[model samples]
Target: MMTIERLREEINKIDEEILSLLNSRASCARQIGELKQKNSLVTYHPAREKEIYRQLLATNHGPLSYDTICAIYTEIISACRGIESPLKIAYLGPEATFTHMAARRKFGSSVEFVPVASIADVFAEVEKKRADYGVVPIENSTEGVITHTLDMFIESNLTICAEILLEISQCLLSNSSLEEIRLVYSHSHAFAQVRGWLKSNLPTTKCIEVSSTAEASRRAAMEQDSAAVGSELAAQVYHLNIMAKGIEDRVDNYTRFLIIGHSMVGRSENDKTSIMFSVKDRVGALHSMLSPFNKHNVNLTKIESRPSKDTIWEYIFFIDMNGHIEDDNVKEAIDELRESCLYLKVLGSYPVAG
Candidate 1:
């Protein structure tokens, strides 16, 4: 057995080695960034990132899980981001919003954050090249799909580069006593999600809708008799008291966020592909579109429809499936799907989290 003194000396040496290697890596990344800038190449290369993580995980040995390895590399990449330019990420916000939280969780606080008033604006910022990426809520386990985000996917040219799943916990925030509160405020979705809880706890309080949960928290902070049903982050940011905690109607509530950018990335061993398509207005059109997946043995995870903004009664179907677009089976399925649908677009194929 090694002595404690010897172990301490070994650990110090390891720490010094890690610091030296990281410094060298950062210098090399800076040089690469300069070359990319000279070639006018964009900094957010999702495909390259996926490839790097895939190779890293493949070579990983015992003592660390795949997620731990990926997380360490994520920070390495984030630190190298400044070698090009501080990545500007757009999110639906006034700051302290869940979207903002997701963005920070994914990219870290080093990247510059641009909070927009609406989801549409977040997409627009990415499309217009004002931001490197946009983070937006795609779906919630309790409340179903966020239709606006799905519609934007159908309408925009953005690709889903990465995804983040956030476990949601909401609280009732106020400045006054629970009995003194006569009104509650929250975004419509948040209210809908916690309707059951509200009925049980504050049945008599009048519910008011606001632009965003952050706004609701702001209103709650300003009005003594009003409370906001929002994330705990909101309460902390707005300096409000938590009247009640864990107030969500369901404990398993989680929201999935999508990172949207300009291009599709290469696939990983574990990946999920998203596509938007419109079936012909004929019998079996939808079935024919999906038949390819069955034939190819591709797993279809989700399918949702939205009204096609261009025409009345026409609809666009969004699909999420296991496997990356580069897989032979996935590519074949897309080819067959294209033949069946009037229109089809592969939104993106990105690595699924471990």
Candidate 2:
């Protein structure tokens, strides 16, 4: 028997209470920030943030889905964290790129986002303290690893603080109709992803390669009868209509981004550790390097090899494994791994991206 008028009145009352609670939370956050500053601690903690999300999601039995709860809390946390200290994050781009999106996903919208020209620029920003952290694409499901990113780690002192896993959905953005489109601008990777779609749909349209999807959208906006293969966010940022969406050859395409910073992240319940090493130049050296992991019952999630730029034909092996470096099993395995390798470096141990 509740009338719409009565329900709206109740909603207004709840909103007022919600505002009050938010202010209280912000006040608490401010106090914590003061303490952190005094003690010389970093503002962001991956494990702490993950614990908050896990607790909220575990208790949620809702009229709203878990995704909805996460979305709401992300903004709320962003606002609260901004009250503490505004973080400056650098990403590869002119804005609206997947790396930008991934940076936003981890830090939220309240922080400052600096879009740079390239992945190396992103690293340089954080290294020089121009930005608090940098987000760069490490690998893509369709195109494989980004070798440049791995190479940067070989010489940089930065640590992997966190990671972001984002699903890539290519969209065709244009000012004109699909039939009127003459040129398509996008990154080489995007072109590779949507090759099949472009072949079938716009076989004759001239495709131009640009630095990024955001740049492509910008070019599409300026040129007549032009389109760009990019993200829906690019469409929004560059003020273009989405002519088509989900145009990638593979529907399951995803990209993994790494958050690099000066501070090391503490361990979480579910964690991943990344390491790089060069095996000794001898028979069965590679096998000897991997045996310790099996002996310690540690699970390796991924392994990739890159040329050691210093020496010809020599390679460095990068690996991702489950568990924190502080864990006894992982620690022991790494000790064993070091014995079989010419050199070993522990990149970081961070909470696995959800």
Best by TM-score: 2
Indicate the residue-level lDDT of 222 in model 2: 94
Tens-place lDDT digits, model 2, residues 223-288:
989999999889999899998889999999999999999977898899999999997567787887
TM-score per candidate, in order? 0.86, 0.98
Per-residue alpha-carbon lDDT of candidate 1 for residues 1-354, written as tens digits (9 for 90 to 100): 999999999999999999999889889889888898999887777657768877887898958988788778878888887766779999999877889888876886668999999999999999999998999999999889999999888779898998888888888999999889999999888898789999988889999998888899999999879999888889899999988888888888899999999877766668899999997677777887788999999999999999987878788999999999889999999998898678999999987843
lDDT of 1 at 154: 73
Question: Highest lDDT: which candidate?
Answer: 2
Clashing pairs in 2: none
lDDT of 2: 0.93
Looking at model 1, the pairs that clash are: none
lDDT of each: 0.87, 0.93
Which portions of model 2 show Cα errors greater than 4 Å? none
